[model samples]
Target chain A: MTKGTLYLIPVPLAEGAEHVSYTPFQLELIDHIKEYIVENEKTARKFLKAAGLKTPQQELRIHDYGKHVRDKVNYQELLAGALRGEDIGLMSEAGCPGVADPGAEVVFEAHKRGIKVVPLIGPSSILLALMASGFSGQNFSFIGYLPIDKGARSKKIKDLEQESQREKRTQLFIETPFRNNQLLSELLKSCKPQTRLCIACNLTAPDEYIRTQTIEKWRSETVDLHKKPCIFLLYAG
Target chain B: MTKGTLYLIPVPLAEGAEHVSYTPFQLELIDHIKEYIVENEKTARKFLKAAGLKTPQQELRIHDYGKHVRDKVNYQELLAGALRGEDIGLMSEAGCPGVADPGAEVVFEAHKRGIKVVPLIGPSSILLALMASGFSGQNFSFIGYLPIDKGARSKKIKDLEQESQREKRTQLFIETPFRNNQLLSELLKSCKPQTRLCIACNLTAPDEYIRTQTIEKWRSETVDLHKKPCIFLLYAG
Candidate 1:
């Protein structure tokens, strides 16, 4: 018997962001998937409802892969339904699954078991930030997050800046919402004066803000990034 | 007077792949724009028509940014409509604009001119490939095309493989459709037997193919990728 396919679904980056949209194909596919492996059960259920799932919430079978239970969950058990020829959906808290999220682990296991993996189209903050940054999209790197240590973070900033300059590649990274301001300040202090920096905050939201300017120019501006989801990109070339 | 917003739009990767879908918000926005800067006028018009454009095709103004005329076109002139307070869209031959395409130049100029740039949600082959590859997506680099010269290409492959192993980061790149097989063969020859490789071809299409296997396992299988659009990912970690 053939195993069921694993569908990778993406959720909105911001809650209540009405502008966040999904393709009809994605919605139709979601309607047929009653089983899921998700980062957070509550949010996933809410999203499924918003996406027009006809299946009743009580009837849905959800396997929690949330951070708190990540270590304890049996990934193979999550796919047991799929092995029995029942299609399963995999979702993250936000954005595309398996990109910069723990969802990749589930996807990795699916591939090992020879299960078909399908990634549906959806909003991705990383891709949107890179597109609007006006940086070199041809060659770019998403380094996830910087070291929390001040000294190490500063060194990483300089190293990424140097690499961007040497290779003409764009470097992208993010920080926890509350620490965004701290990261922004460190970036201004660690990067060269002429290196370009782009701060894309609240993407796809009603009050989205995206701007790219040189570090020297950014130093003169007064902006607060406290407690707002944001993606930072650097391009020295 | 405020400058008009520049919308970065995405087109389907394969022609007549009707399974490809877009957002309602995207369709609504496309209805309001009558001017576009596109890689190919023919395909752009076809996509717009299929996307439910209410305006007649003859009334729209298109700026040709196709490869044949890329060097001659004045990018500023393409944004003339936006500068004049009329929204304009930027599109590539396929996938997301400003990503691995000449659309970035236009987006860069938009930033310099303080034009608002918004990237709409849509299909992106690179992002989808990474999601389905089951490789490390927390950190990854898209190196674009490799050196076409045989020796340089092999050396670069080795270098990327080393970097992937060291950083536990996925490395993604593409080649002209015709050169895909050549690149695949080279990757198999240059990488270690344990390195993981993913071939994502004709993504989002009916016959979409995505598979990840170690170099040793791949050598035992027979597959053809002669002229198919494909993204190759390597992860030694």
Candidate 2:
């Protein structure tokens, strides 16, 4: 018997942004997938509904892979349905699955089982930010998050800045939303004066803001990024 | 007076893949924007027509930034429409604008002129390949292309494998379509047996192929990748 394919679906970066985040084809694909492995069941069901899932919410089979259950879940058991010829959809809490999320483990498991993996197109904040950053997209790095330790974070920032200058590559990283302001101040203090910095906040939202400016110019201005989803890009070259 | 926003648009990576690559909101936005700065005039016009552009092709203003004219083009003049309060769209030959394309220069010019930059949702091969590669997405780098010289390319591949093992970061890069098979052979020869490699070709197309395996296993298989657009990802961890 042939194994069913695994579809990696993407959720919107922000709430209520589905209209611009999903394509008609994605909605049609999801309509045929009744089983899913999602980061969070509640949000995933809500998203599936938004994406026009025709199946009743309760009738659809969902295996939660959220933070609380991630460690205890069996990777192979997740693909058992696919092995039984049932197409399974994989989704994260936000953005694309398998990137900056625990979904990669499931995808890896699918590969081990010889199942086909198909990735659909959707809104990815990291990709969107890089597109609007005005940086060297030819060579870029997305380092998920910096160290939480103050000293280590500072050192990482400086290292990224130096590498950016030496290689002429764009360095991208994100910070926790509540600590956004703190990270912003730290970035300004840690990077060189002439390094170009681009702060993209609330991507794909009504209040989206994206701008690139030199560290020197940013230091002279004041902006609050507290509790805002943002992607910070640095390019010293 | 408020300057017009610079909309960075993305074209489907493969021909006739727009149905799955673009959202309805993107089509609506393009319908209203009659001016565009594109890498190739012929392809861009064809893409716009496929994307549901209502404006007559002859009535639209297009600034060609194709390879031959890229060096001679004055970027400031490309944004003349936006400067005069008309929204301008920026597109590349394929995939997202301002990424691995000459569109970055135009975006940078827009930032310098204080024009707002908005990125629309679409398919990005690099992002999609990472999503399905079952590799580390937490920390990844797109180094664009490796050195062309035989010795230099070999050394670079070894260095990337080492870096991937040390940092647990996925290394993504591409080769000229015709050189894909050559690069594949070089990678199998330069890396350790356990290092994982994923080759994603003709992404988002009917013939799309994505798979991951260790170097040892890949050496035992035979495949042809000549003249096919592809992305190579490495993960030694």
Candidate 3:
């Protein structure tokens, strides 16, 4: 009979400005919360410092969230406290905590222990990029990042393009900060002329660019795509 | 040169409760925004009244959102103002507004008009479902919903499943509330035996369920998948 409540907090999407994804309305109730579990100790300290967040406000460093694949020990301890009626906030480095970040294991553990998991939307590049990309929203797929191998990566693009066409499902993917331009070149070379492509770069930041264009146009265009880290969405019509 | 910003506001995930995907950090600023936006109308009046949201504060016209959406003329006028740099909050009936929701149009239109589209994090069923599916979150897809036609929908599922398997990508989809069970049955019948399927129903709700099993297990077992809108994830591996 344990009911622990875990709040999955979404962090800022870009460097300076915050991304719109995690907007947990109840988060203003910082006083209601007594414990916070974060991916990194320093970040937890920094976030507390940055925002001046506090409950009883005592800092509790249980252990690294990475201590175990499941981190059952620390997880159970947190859940135990939560079951005794404690408010807990779980955080990761950036983006949404449980998506591509490190809160999945904690979320699962919390669930197994019958804890109520509440997600707060603040910032997520994936959903924002998908929305900004004029691709088909009716159906779409997000493959976090492309493979590193050039040949395999190109094959992946071909496969994704094919899937989008056959299924009428929009295909979305991301690349490393360094490999963005290279990925664009490959997309232009490999994707068909009619395919719809969108590049959402520096999302939420001052220099944000959500450029939606056809592969043909993108192939011939000269755009400052290198402005910042970006999300790539491709649709095969 | 208005420099209008786009706010991707998240509405509730369920009827009475607030959405979990929304982070509290962002909601703090929204409180400040209400003062500016509601020069004429109080935010508590406009936002809560429009969304039909009820609180200890006042009698909620939950049906107001329906009425608001139905009043096409009035709604478009609101859109006009938002497009003109009023910094309107893009909200939905529930969940993240822009992803698969009709509000995405404004985001796209905003980008076209050179306005800044800012996405704040909050409760999104899509990312939450993906995190719980136990599938590889690193590379996954969000295909919003399936078609109503049986033939076309079946074909779409087959194609997506094939791609998921071939590319080792996770295919995610959501269903209308009433059609959830039907969709689950169809998924069991259509997806291959080895394909790993996950069902996240009533996410963040009291009766929420996150079940992962093979197609065969899903088909052979008795599942009480009813009443709630659900997200389906089928992984290639």
Candidate 4:
């Protein structure tokens, strides 16, 4: 039997938003996969069920490897089934895997073993936010999450601003849901007043809000994003 | 009537590969959109027809842009239908719009007019290639296209390598289809032997090939990518 391919699956950015966020083709593809490496099995099972997976959840072989799964895992073991001609999928809890998520290791392994890797189209908050922000689409960088410490985070934001100015590159980063407001406050205080900031909140959801404004304008407005997942993008150029 | 939203639509990377590259939702969305701001009206109609558009090609209101169609388009005029409760879709000739495409102008205008912008998930050769590359996803930059001049291009490659080494960021860029092999040859000769490069060719198609190797390893191989669209990624970290 030929070695099976590994599929990089993209999931919805938020719960209950799949209908609008995912294409029917993505859903159909999700249903056919028998083995999956996901950020969370519980969340993955829910997504698969919503996507119309026919197999019983108990019967499906799932390897969870995100924050919750603490046990040391052999990355090669996850792809063992694929090597034996059983196609497998790598999924993240939200958005596309291997993108600010944990599916990269599996994809890296697939490359090493010469196994074909197919990336399916689905909701990716980063790309979606960038598409909507109207920022510099030609040159941009995704810096993942920001530093947790206050001083470091502030310094990093300034550095990113400097880089954006120098390279004319848009800088993108995310913050924890609850710290959404704090990050915004930090950005408003740290970045230059003229630096443009795009706040994409609860993307692809009913409450989706994406706005790009100068830091000065954002500072003047009374805003409250208590616990919504948000992506912050700043451009000094 | 409520103001219609702006949809950032994704198109196939290449011709005749829509079935596998686009999701059913994307196709359905295309069928429903009456007005489209595309890279080219001719190509947009062809794509719509292939995606099962029910409207007659002549009846579809398409405003062509890109390298041709010299009239300076009034972006607000293109979106006037959306203000009148008619949903408008911004589409590129290939891949996701607003990214290395001409769709960002409309998205920027949408924000100014307070019109909702909905980004539908679909194939993005850049993201797909990065997902498959196993590079530093934590920090990565998309530089779009490099300089065409020999000296400038070489200098830019060196600068990118230096940035990648210092920041541990993955650098991504694309080339004109016919110049794929030329870019590869230049990269092999200009970049350090140990610098890793991943060439993603004909992404999301039957002949898709994504391979990563040291610059030295690629130097000895025979490659011919005559006119295939490709994404090139490199990292020194």
Candidate 5:
């Protein structure tokens, strides 16, 4: 067995470095790591450049995970890299790694290999949205995205709505940037008038919007659906 | 219009300074506030004592929330406390202010009265559990606590399990401390053998355990049912 470690570094939900405050233990882990892996080499360089003196843009190399093929991940090669007594930081495009991103396999493999894995807290839209949604939190789930087809998506909505109403669960899901309008319209058209919806738009940003209202109210009113990316959630009594 | 600030203070899971790491910004928010509405009198004293000192025994003055009974909150009295230049820190017994707590009513009321509500980042089991579950985060649901009655609870589980399978959603829920064993047994008994289960126990603690296994494996395993405080997560693929 080789000694290795994996850092699941959570990036900010939105831009700006002020929000990336790692806990004392987490920062220490990052500072001691010998190898760094970022989603994009360019972004990794920028992060290092911002650090001024101690940051390693050159020595601590980054792996290029091109849009994550979701199939062709070189697990052994990555494991070989880890076996070289190097620690890797798996950075997601945004939010927590492995939640809606490409770090799941790496985490799973690392665990299988008995490599120590540490996840640093920074920012997460899923948790932030949940905090403000005013929904039941004892138990909740977050499915990253949904089918784009209106028919398939509508059926999914119906199922989620039934779960929310009949099971006393709060349903949470999101959509792509361009399809938000279509999804919002479908939500208004399908869900009952009394079902509660919480739309967290551009979370952790200056123009952040956390709007909660009934579907009836949303249908009667006009909201700028194009303003930002959103994590739309529904809660039914 | 009355102007006031609503602070979302993150308390520890258990009362201890080591268990909490209040950020500099959060501490600053606490220091500047003269009027704060805490959850209870003892917690108020605990906060005050912890705020200005290095430990939990220091002296600091904090206003108690008195109670959470809807009619007994005396919203007008709290408003008066705010109007008189009180920076109200809506503290909960544990975790963040909103989820699984009663600060939402105050936060909502503050929003209605045009108060500035600022939420801080701290320990939240919901976020920690979801992060480590490794379930599909794209679509998920959170149902708080389940009914204890065997018949009603079993029916609810069946409905939730069916919905999750139909929609491929992750159903999240919790149980009372003493009822965890009963719930786990019910989950294994009612849900299909192939249904995916993720149990997050003692999250964020050194004794934390998060396992994702099928219900079939769970039924035959020698799992200790004495673990009281835990979160049960179901994912039917």
Candidate 6:
């Protein structure tokens, strides 16, 4: 039998239950899959229900293989069904799967084993933030999360800012929900006044806020990004 | 009047008439948007018609601001409708707008003018290819297109591969449609035998082909990617 295809499905960025975030094509694809390897079973089930999956919860087989489930799980077992000609879906807690998440390892192993992988269109905070940031889309780097330590984190920011200036590229990074404001403050303090900064908060939520301005302009504004998922982009050139 | 929102819309990747590439939500948005800034007015019209846009052909306002029209047209006038509380949609010839396309300029100018930009969930070939490549998802750089000169192109490829090795990052780049085969041949001839390369061809189309293998294994395969839009990803680490 041919190896089963793996689908990299995307989830909504917001947590609201009423959010209709997926495309019809994506929803159609979700309804057809019976197996899923998700970051959180509860949220995955909720997302599936929202997508209007045809299969009942009792018939669906879901395996937890997210960041929380790492270390205890042998990933091979996750793809075992796929190897036996059963299509499997991979879902992240939010946004596109295998992107700044633990699903990359799964995708890596699937590629190594030569299984078919398909990615469905959905909201990606990173890409959406960058798209609205008005930065260099032609050349950019996603640096994921920065170091947490004060000194190390500050140094990394400086390095990334310098790289952005030198290469004329957009540098993207995310922060913990609570640390969003802290990172913004640090960015304003460390980067040059003329360096452009874009803060995209609650990307797809009803209260979405996406604004791009210079560090100087950001410093003057009264901003409160506490406990919100935010993407910070900087481009000096 | 309040400033209108800017929507970044996605177009079908192939020219096939039978392809239903958009989601229902996308179709709804397209139907409501009367103003569009597109890469190709003809193709954009065709796409809108297929997506069930309700606006008649004569009433739909499409202003072409692609690379070819860069110096020929003033873009600010295109968004005048949006600035007067009218929503404007931006569409590309294929794939998502403002991504690897000239729509970024319009998006950038919108940011400068403090306009709201909303990116609808749609197909993005770059993210799709990366998700399937099984390479480094946490740290990656998209270097749009390689230099056209033979020597510069080869050198750029080597530099990108070296950077990929040093950073454990996935390096992504594209080539002109006609140069697709030439770039693949160069990649096969230049990269190390163990380096991993994935070519995502005819993305989102029925003939979609996504395969990843070591340089050694790819050498044995016959590849003819002529006149096809393809994304090439390589990871040496």
Predicted structure with the largest lDDT when compared to the true one: 2
| lDDT by residue for model 4 (B33-115), tens | 88988888788887888888987787778877666653577867888989988888989878888887777767877887878
TM-score of 6: 0.94
Give me the TM-scores of chain B across the candidates: 0.96, 0.98, 0.76, 0.94, 0.86, 0.94
* Alpha-carbon runs more than 4 Å astray in model 6: A16-20, B16-21
Superior by TM-score: candidate 1 or candidate 5: 1
lDDT measured at residue A177 in model 3 versus the true structure, 0 to 100 = 74
lDDT value, candidate 5, whole model: 0.68
List each candidate's DockQ score. 0.75, 0.87, 0.32, 0.62, 0.34, 0.63
CA shift of B100, model 2, Å: 1.4
In order of appearance, the predictions have TM-scores of 0.97, 0.98, 0.74, 0.93, 0.81, 0.94
C-alpha lDDT of all candidate models, in order: 0.89, 0.92, 0.66, 0.84, 0.68, 0.84
10 residues in a row with least lDDT, candidate 4 chain B? B16-25
True contacts kept of each: 0.70, 0.84, 0.43, 0.57, 0.26, 0.64
- Cα RMSD for candidates in order: 1.4, 1.0, 6.1, 2.2, 4.1, 2.0
Badly placed stretches (over 4 Å) of model 2 are: none
What is the clash count of model 2? 0
User: How would you encode candidate 1's per-residue C-alpha lDDT over B68-123 as one tens digit per residue?
Assistant: 88778776787889999999999987889988877877888888889999888888
Q: Name the best candidate (by DockQ).
A: 2
Number of backbone-clashing residue pairs for each candidate, in the order shown: 0, 0, 50, 0, 13, 0
Residue A10 of candidate 6: its Cα lDDT? 85
Which lDDT tens digits does candidate 6 get at residues B1-237? 689999988787766522335656676787788899988888888888777778798998889876777877765797888888899998887777777776777887888887899876667788888888888788888889899999998898899889889988889899888989999999988899999999999887878888888999999999899998899999998
Poorest 10 consecutive residues of model 3 chain A by lDDT? A18-27
List, residue by residue over A1-237, the lDDT tens digit for candidate 5. 567767676665666633333344555555666566567777756654543326554677667665755467677777666766677777767777767665665665665565656555556677667666666554455766777677998998988888778756666788887778888999999999989888888876777777677899889988776747898988785
lDDT of 4: 0.84
For each model, chain A TM-score? 0.96, 0.97, 0.86, 0.94, 0.90, 0.95
